[model samples]
Target: MNKGLTAKGRATRQRIVVATALLTREKGAAETTLDDVRAATATSKSQLFHYFPEGRSDILTAVAEYEAGQVLDVQQPFLGDLSTWESWQKWRQAVLDHYIELGQRCPLGSLTTELGKSSAEARAILTTLFTEWEEALFLGVRTLTSAEPEAARIRARSILAAIQGGVVMLQATGVTDYLTAALMTSTDPLRPTAEGTD
Candidate 1:
């Protein structure tokens, strides 16, 4: 999308996306309008349309992508290296903390839910996010276990599912118990065994 833009053009486009994302997170996709975005970003209507020719849908899609990146960005450092049990715990805590901070309003979840019904592009963006997130967990699982590739893949998927389910529950109940339990139980396969137990 940024194929032939000058540095300033790219920055302005990014500024719009970032501001729109923040607005959506605060007021929700349905509530956030193009005018809201323009006012928030201090961009003229022409400039907003220039960056997002398709209007609100295009802007929402961009915000969805931005929120997707944020899902992984928060889990950094620990998510980058989950080779050890300690590292995995840190990642788990990071995930929990992120959701707690977000509370019931998950920007990515809300954006995808709002747009996925009407836009294939939005669904694709969500699919890509899940694929990359699961792959990162798979790499970490492989690092921590002697499981075969297929087993590691299954384990990683389960962990990802657990996390997603927990997040949903947390959003619904305003409780973190489900997420905590899911993270703890999902990592059981990687728990250290007793001495000389094979």
Candidate 2:
């Protein structure tokens, strides 16, 4: 249970977060005013301030956390449990399909950019998100390769870096080839060796 939240409190917070997420996605972080959030969530100013004392920055931070969760949420069971090649493929497709559908506009990207990704708080949030995401990929890679766990961790970081760089290029160009190449190339080395007539 989340210690800070009563059931109703939790529900209200979720409503605010989801509403903020949609507004950010649709309007970009720059244009999503507190009034917009208030109207979208049907939340009173007092209630919004009660839940987030720091107002927009606080809500933006919370929304960033929410969006971070969402980035992987679409991958579902495959992202959670990647013990098989089939699961990896599914996860890959989910990630690709998600960005493809989203096109150049990325709510999460907008939020991070608006919040100053270089800031200590923003970096910390991103670090946590990437850490968790890389861990999931690391486990799958380890399972597939039977390598040292640490090796998998290193590879996972590399893979994550590649994917992030790819996503940046993708957002700039409205192209997905960079993302696809990043994932494919990162995992290419992990492909099992097979005997051939040579």
Error of 1 at 20 (Å): 1.5
Q: Per-residue alpha-carbon lDDT of model 1 for 31-124, expressed as tens digits?
A: 8898899889989999988888999988888888888888889999899998777888788888888887887676545655564543678788
Question: What are the lDDT figures for the candidates, one per model?
Answer: 0.81, 0.77
TM-score of each: 0.86, 0.81
Q: What is the lDDT of residue 39 in candidate 2?
A: 93
Backbone clash pairs for candidate 1 read none
Model 2 misplaced regions, further than 4 Å: 1-9, 115-120, 193-198
- For model 1 the local lDDT of residue 161 reads 88
Give stretches of model 1 more than 4 Å off.
193-198
Clash numbers, per candidate = 0, 0
Report clash pairs, candidate 2: none
Best by TM-score: 1
Q: Which ten residues in a row have the lowest lDDT in candidate 2?
A: 189-198
lDDT of 1 at 176: 78
Assess candidate 1 and give its lDDT.
Answer: 0.81
